[model samples]
Target: MSNQKIYQYLMAFGHFCSDINQTALTALLPFLIAIHHYDYTTAAMLVLVANMVSSVVQPLFGHLADKFNWVWIVPVGLLLAGGGIAATGYTSDFWQLCLAVMISGIGIAMFHPQAAKLVNLASGLHNRGTALSIFAFGGSTGAAMGPILITASIALFGVQGTLTFLLIELLACLMIGRYYRALTELNGGSIKAKQANAQATQQDQWGAFSVLCVVMFGRSIIYYGLNTFLALYWINVLGTTETVGNTMLSIYYTIGAICTLFGGKLADKFGARNVLKCGFAVLFPSIALLAMTGNELFASALLLPMGAAIHIVYSPTVVLGQQYLPNRIGFASGITLGLAISIGGITAPILGKIADIYGLTTALYSVALVPLVGAFLLAKPKD
Candidate 1:
């Protein structure tokens, strides 16, 4: 394989490492509630805090990446992301837990824009969708692994098991550092290419971009809603063991990972917009069915199509966002992959409250409505 391929894969691996911590905290939610006797809303507050910080800061980091080479932030962010989550197990105070989660959020904020910018640069123009799909695949796989890893760690070491992510991220940072030169070279190429294309006139489509952001926001709601509550829904509503619940979560993300890879290829063949529309169309019914079903075996079976519907749009959205704002790819990435995505986390507390008052099923049914709005937006004339 070429050096570029190796570097691309390395970036994807780094993404895997960074995202492992993202889902790890969610996976630990049950443990947190049981061990500390926290209520649903309070436990969901941690997700709110983390995503709030991440959503706010990620754009600034992306703007900074656009203005200058900030490749070093990648490894540093990885370290902090891992360290913050790792500290969660040791904290007993709610405020302290919030602070720890905030730290991880900042770390995540620091990592995504620069890393995505580098990946875009490395992939060049031809196969950007495929490259980004690989990147998304890494994140999806890490998300899938989060529940299993945390479950196993907790089984062996109790709540303190969160430290496993620290060790894993440290190794990832070292590996990234070893390839630091290659990454810088890719960034350098991006700079040179920008200079060369200084005379080229590619207009930014803000109107369409705005519409896309709205669609993505709706998608984010569905994604984060499921990520935060699916396991709880399984355990509480379906009368399953914690292990079974987490296994269901793992299955959801594992299928999502596989679909993300193929989604990119399909986008490359068809069109990103077409694939995106199909995804939203599929997502609505899948989520609606999931919300209505009480049968454990059938609900488990639904994860296959549900995971596909959610993730099939992942790479296409990122690629389209960058295409829309060609000059500010990093900033576009921050909005699409970070802000748009993390904003969904903002609703977790609200959903938790709904789940607290009404029920998990009601919260899930509420989540199911979001994609229909996304589908409506997609049906509008192309921006």
Candidate 2:
């Protein structure tokens, strides 16, 4: 096909790989604990360290993407991440595993912002929302596939075999990157284009941006908590099989991926504020259902919207973030895609501690309260 098409595909695939690594690691942590005799504290710390690296580096990369051309960062970062993840299967010690996680995190940190910048360049204004919806869906799909992939690998090759899976993903990324080389701008010249775009946006939109950030903080906490901890709860408290529990988690991510596009369309048709509020509203019932129910069938049904409610805010909030900082699309993307999400990842350990101490049910109930805080923060009437 065309060079431009190849470039967009490569950029999207890069985003896909970055997301899969994050989700795969989250899925692998508890299993790693089981196989290696590491405790919950260590598992929590591993996730925290990985996420911390991504959170800290993404904003810097965002800034670089705005000021300079850094197209090569995406592929190099993916290769590093792939190598780190593959090596995790070889390490037997706790510290070695942590180092591997740290390496993977650094790789992901480099990939996301640069790849997102490329997607923004590929999509035009009229179709930006739709294009971004597809782009975001790639990440969501990775999140959805992670648990299944990890479980399958563990079943077939045991823990060590998981490394082969990671290696394959990395090789896929390398091939995609090489094939899309035409999209790589050789000169550091995109700064002027970015600047000109920024100049065209209305500067008075900061109020909208601030409100959106608060909403993001709220959505992220619930999403990460559910993604990381729900399987543990299902197995520990509810007495479900590990496979059943993972399937439930998978269902949640699937609904989340679907609703991201729906939420974006709803926002485009109505408004981001209203769509965002509705997303928060969905959380109250979904979280309550998850916390209070013991029935497997009931919990599975409720998980449909539980996932949807948690992620429906994603697309709208993303669009709002871009609108708020039209001049700095890359920076805005880092905030929505990386920084705010990192804030959520950083909190995963604290959430794990709470679950460990207070009981999983109580910890979940406490998380259910997060949307209220988000709602309060977002309740500032539209400007």
Global lDDT scores for all candidate models: 0.86, 0.73
lDDT of 2 by residue, 282-378 (tens): 8977897789988877877888878888777776676667767766667778878877776677778888788778877877887898888654444
Which ten contiguous residues of candidate 2 have the minimum total lDDT? 183-192
CA deviation > 4 Å runs, candidate 1: 190-200, 375-383
Model 1, TM vs. native: 0.96
Best by TM-score: 1
Clashing pairs in 2: 198-327
Instruction: Quantify how close model 1 is to the true structure by its C-alpha RMSD in Å.
Output: 2.0
- Model 1, 12-44: lDDT tens digits are 888888888888888889889888998889999
Clash statistics: count for each candidate: 0, 1
TM agreement with the true structure for every prediction: 0.96, 0.90
Regions of model 2 farther than 4 Å from truth = 1-8, 186-201, 375-383
